[model samples]
Target: MSSQASLRPAVVLSLVLVVWALTGLTHAQPKASVLDFSASLGNLLPSLSRPANSSRIFYGVMFDAGSTGTRIHVYTFIQKDPEELPVLDNEMFHSIKPGLSAYADMPEMGGYTVRQLLKVAKKTVPRLEWKRTPLVLKATAGLRLLPSEKSQALLEQVQDVFDESPFFVPDDSVSIMNGTNEGILAWVTVNFLTGHLYAETRETVGILDLGGGSTQITFLPKSKKTIGSSPDDYIARIDMFNSTYELYTHRTCIKYLLCHVIHRPPYIIVLLYTPGLEWRVFKSSCLPKKFREEWSFGGLTYIVSGKPDGESYVGYKLCYQEVLKVVKDIVHQPYELKDTSVFYAFSYYFDRAVDAGLIDRTQGGMLEVRDFKKRAKEVCNKMSKYRPINPFLCMDMTYITCLLKDGFGFKENTVLQLTKKVNNVETSWALGATFNHFQNLKIHR
Candidate 1:
């Protein structure tokens, strides 16, 4: 037989494998509109030649439009069989600075920014599979802080871009996620990636997500006091993978810790702008005695500094008092938090820990709550030296220390695992959101 004729059978076999892998079943139904020609070849194959589908691979692209930056997570997943959940094979991640919220005034520019990131996805997903890949963008506290009209404009612009792209876009492709869902999804991502979801013991770690405009604390309450004492809105029920989790979620203001505190409200601060007062400054004991600078957040700039006339004591004690005002009386202490429950801190939590040199940036380590207090004192007292490295380090550290002790009511010796990634996947809500999208689309089935 000729070489060309012999190669034809191998090509036919390869086509059959591709079809089986895409469809996931030997008895095919109507071809899904999302799949292209190659995925619909199952009907042409002879019944005797059909083989059981062993493994199938798919892709999902999720964009995390955060306060500080925009990140793209292109996830590759593999399924061993039709009845099983897809396993995360690998992730292609990239980021750009100054978040989408930065373009509130110029929304088209924000769309262009998203377009730039989509190039990464285009390069990562195969050309033949582009039409089937799902594209989604979920904005966090940064965009949530914007005026309703402004945020909607940004989302509309992003939707326009998604409409133009070759990838599959759902009806609710781009939107700002509420704080409660954000916390729950992060918890899901951590527990799922950590193998705690399928564990027989039902032990799961809590998540502390500190962001630019706000912060979230989510965990499964071991004690009845935590559930009974919490406000009705603070508890949320999440149904996933045939299990229901009654999670306790708390959304608090952390923006003042990052930017400037405008007014001394109870738990949250209402941001206001004065037209002609550039010299007006917000004072905080958490800052160095002589520190004065201009800081910005949520598209507004504020002058903030330490009190120049106060007593010459600037350390953890005073800084903790200043930070305490932001969290005390506002945050409820969960009964289980005082015990040995492990907590994973991320976002600004991980960043501040690394900035204070309490943990390594690459290989994160475990540290007790007292460790943050110790480091806060050192950073606050030695501000002259570390100021150039990060002017806000002292305030940030003090706030974190205060947030843990007085805010969330963690014990002094309570351990916190600081990490930015788990199993090479980002410790963010993006992964869980991607999984949710896949489930909603029924792509796995």
Candidate 2:
């Protein structure tokens, strides 16, 4: 709410990050211990800061306060000549575990994580550019799921840390980003990297980003009926690359089963795999009945298990039925999905597909809606075979299938391009968000 202004600016996507060095792994990335990971990230810098006099190079630091983890992205921009527009030059990325929400009761601890990631930014950016460089952080599902008082406490702590740092901290530098913006920013990043943003042709692909805390669907609706028949708020008008885009976008909750129970404050997520979740046990059909383990996420731990000795048999049918209730009637189905549209699904979508051998981990591939259904059936039927990889793989796959088909109402044959990154940068909202911040765009409703 800090940067919500009436005046808006034209977003030039051409100047966004051209290539950023990013790291990617499976559902969980770089399984390094928290101690070693923090050490590695902090010690990567050759010097405290590089001294440079030329103003041709610009730096921006963006911290992604995600539900699963906290990551820092340092982006460098260069303009060869004063008349020419700036383009991306270089970037560095790193992350730490247990998102900000995990420290709901201990806001200072959350600030410590931000402080640690800030060190990476200092080492990445030049000393001369520190004062001019913008440092900002936007939180996603994790903090959004916490109690208002608790989430606000966490943000305030982060703001304090940002102010103490040498980098420039603009108004609303640390805040919880709405899900709709998350989806739209991602649309910008993907379209630009995929050649749709700057191309003469206006053809752009739809995007589906399913994170642990929230899920988003955004696309340029081709059919008039879609815009006319849908809810008024689902339609958003924005300017990008000097063109106006009336995109059909919606932000839906998909944090395990917590999406529906959002009205209950002091929120809690279901079926998350994290550390220190040993207090309570959660049972779901998504896992094998005989399976039992400790799952952790958002700073809390819970004992998770499939139905015990007396529970009914667990398989695709049962798992789908259980996860279906979480999305039924709650998610809106836009018209014209079967024709004239292509979609790119990433985040949890790509991770689960990789776990099921449905796509290559390195180079993502395409798949029909039914491919998920088929894989979900195979994995759920033989949980033993896939359980070694991830105990919740069957449930997660089933959830994706249900979300695409029943939730968003996509046709079974609808083609979805699954990828983790495009053009060397991670396929995320960070780049698009950075563009919005670098230009100081207002957050308009």
Using lDDT, give the best candidate's number.
2
The weakest ten consecutive residues by lDDT in model 2 span 1-10
RMSD for each of the candidates: 8.9, 11.6
User: For each candidate, what is the lDDT?
Assistant: 0.70, 0.72
TM-score of each: 0.79, 0.75
Query: lDDT of candidate 2 vs native?
Result: 0.72
Cand. 1 Cα-lDDT: 0.70
Residue 376 miss distance in model 2 (angstroms): 1.7
lDDT of 2 by residue, 49-160 (tens): 3333223567778899987689887877664443344556565778898789889999999999899988888888888768757788999878877889999999999989
Clashing pairs in model 2, backbone N/Cα/C closer than 3 A: 274-296, 276-301, 277-301, 277-302, 278-301
Per-prediction tally of clashes: 0, 5
